[model samples]
Target: MRERGFRLIRLLEYAGLLVVLIATLAAAGQEIALMYRQGRVTVADLLMLFIYLELLAMNGIYWRAGRLPVRMPLYIAIVAMARHLTLETPDMNAWTTLAEGGTVLLLSLAVLVVRYGHIRLPYRDEDPDNIGGRRS
Candidate 1:
């Protein structure tokens, strides 16, 4: 029936997600090893590694719960922006640094907002009309 087909598609999607997560981790590990061997652990390198790890973790968490929380990626973005600013040379304009720094602050706020929602206002309704606590 259609239900079975839908389930099969979901299974396939989950499999693909797993593969993508594994590949990301593998690539991140390779990059980390290269950085280590080269005796270089710059801010940019660390940020890239952290982003990769966060993505892989997010994928795993989603696979388990059939949901992806918004906070993880927001935190990752904040870290990435910080790294971008840190790696920039002194000659970079003040405005550029301030813009990137402001972005990081916004991302941090987003993460905090999402976390507060999940913790302070846990979703309890299961009605289809209120899917994920949103009007459908």
Candidate 2:
């Protein structure tokens, strides 16, 4: 019974992920279409697209591995901070800009730490195929 319940939960997770994947794709398509109509792509627009790309990659990783890495969202946050800074610099005060930049720097450092930890103390039975990072 527990195994069946787990299967049901996993099925629901797949369904939810599928919805997110579709939404991400649709949003990306709309962004592209809007850019086409505008006839010009600003750095902000490119950054938005890159964020979408990262989301898709995150989703793909979760689907393939049944686990999400700690770094993907941090990377997204860093990109988002940069995008926010770029778009808001004209109106942002120096303090706010500095804070946002610092946020990005902190997130970058976090990624490095997580990566180092993974390398220096990897799972003893991590699966190279990314299948739940467990040995059979």
Candidate 3:
């Protein structure tokens, strides 16, 4: 029964992921179409496309690995913050701009810390049941 439940849950996860992947592709296509209509691509358009690419990569990695890395979302967040600041800089107040810049910096530092931890303290086992690879 437990195994059956896990299987069902995994099926739902795959379905959800497939939906997200399709939606992302559609959005990217729309963005490209809009750029074509405008006859030129701007920095904001490029950043938005880059975000889509990152989402696709993240989806692919999750599908293959059965696990999502913490860094992938962090990278996406950093790019998103940059994009937001770029688009809003003209009208944004000084404090708001500083806050956004600080957020990007913090996310970058988080990525570095996660990378360091993964390298310095590598996982010894792939078993999910084995917490931290410590034997009971």
Candidate 4:
């Protein structure tokens, strides 16, 4: 019964992942269509597409390995902040711009720190294919 319950949970997780992947792809398609209608692609549009790609990649990694790297969401956050700055700069006050930029900078620093830690202090039972660092 426990095993069956675990299997059911895993199935639900996979179904949820499938829904997210499909939604992300559909959003990307809509964004592309909007770009076509506007007849111009700006930096903000590209950044938005990048966010979509990162999300898809994150989903793919989790689906394949059953784990997610800590850095993935940080990268997404950095890109998202940058996108927000680009989209809002015109109407935002100088202080607001500075604050947003600082947030992105902090996120970038976080990514660097996370990468450095992964490289400099890896887990004792690290698996190249697994992010969970589970011992076998």
- Minimum summed lDDT over a 10-residue window in model 2 is located at 125-134
| TM-score for each of the candidates | 0.79, 0.89, 0.92, 0.85
lDDT of 4 by residue, 1-136 (tens): 8668768987998999999999999999999999999999999999999999999999999898776789999999999999999898999999999999999989989999999999999755544445366555
Best by TM-score: 3
Scored against the true structure, residue 94 in model 2 reaches a CA lDDT of 91
Task: Summing lDDT over every window of 10 consecutive residues in candidate 4, give the lowest-scoring window.
Answer: 123-132
Cα lDDT of model 2 by residue, 1-136, tens digit = 8668778988999999999999999999999999999999999999999999999999999999887899999999999999999899999999998899899999999999999999998755454445565545
For model 1, the stretches where C-alpha displacement exceeds 4 angstroms are 89-91, 125-136
Per-candidate local distance difference test: 0.80, 0.91, 0.92, 0.91
lDDT score for candidate 2 against the true structure:
0.91
Instruction: Give candidate 4's root-mean-square deviation (CA, Å).
Output: 3.5
Ranking by TM-score: 3, 2, 4, 1
* Candidate 1 global TM-score: 0.79
- Residue-wise lDDT of candidate 3 within 60-82, one digit each (tens)? 99899887889999999999998
lDDT: the better of candidates 1 and 3:
3
lDDT of 1 at 56: 84
Off by over 4 Å in 4: 123-136
Candidate 4, 113: how far from true, in Å?
Answer: 1.9
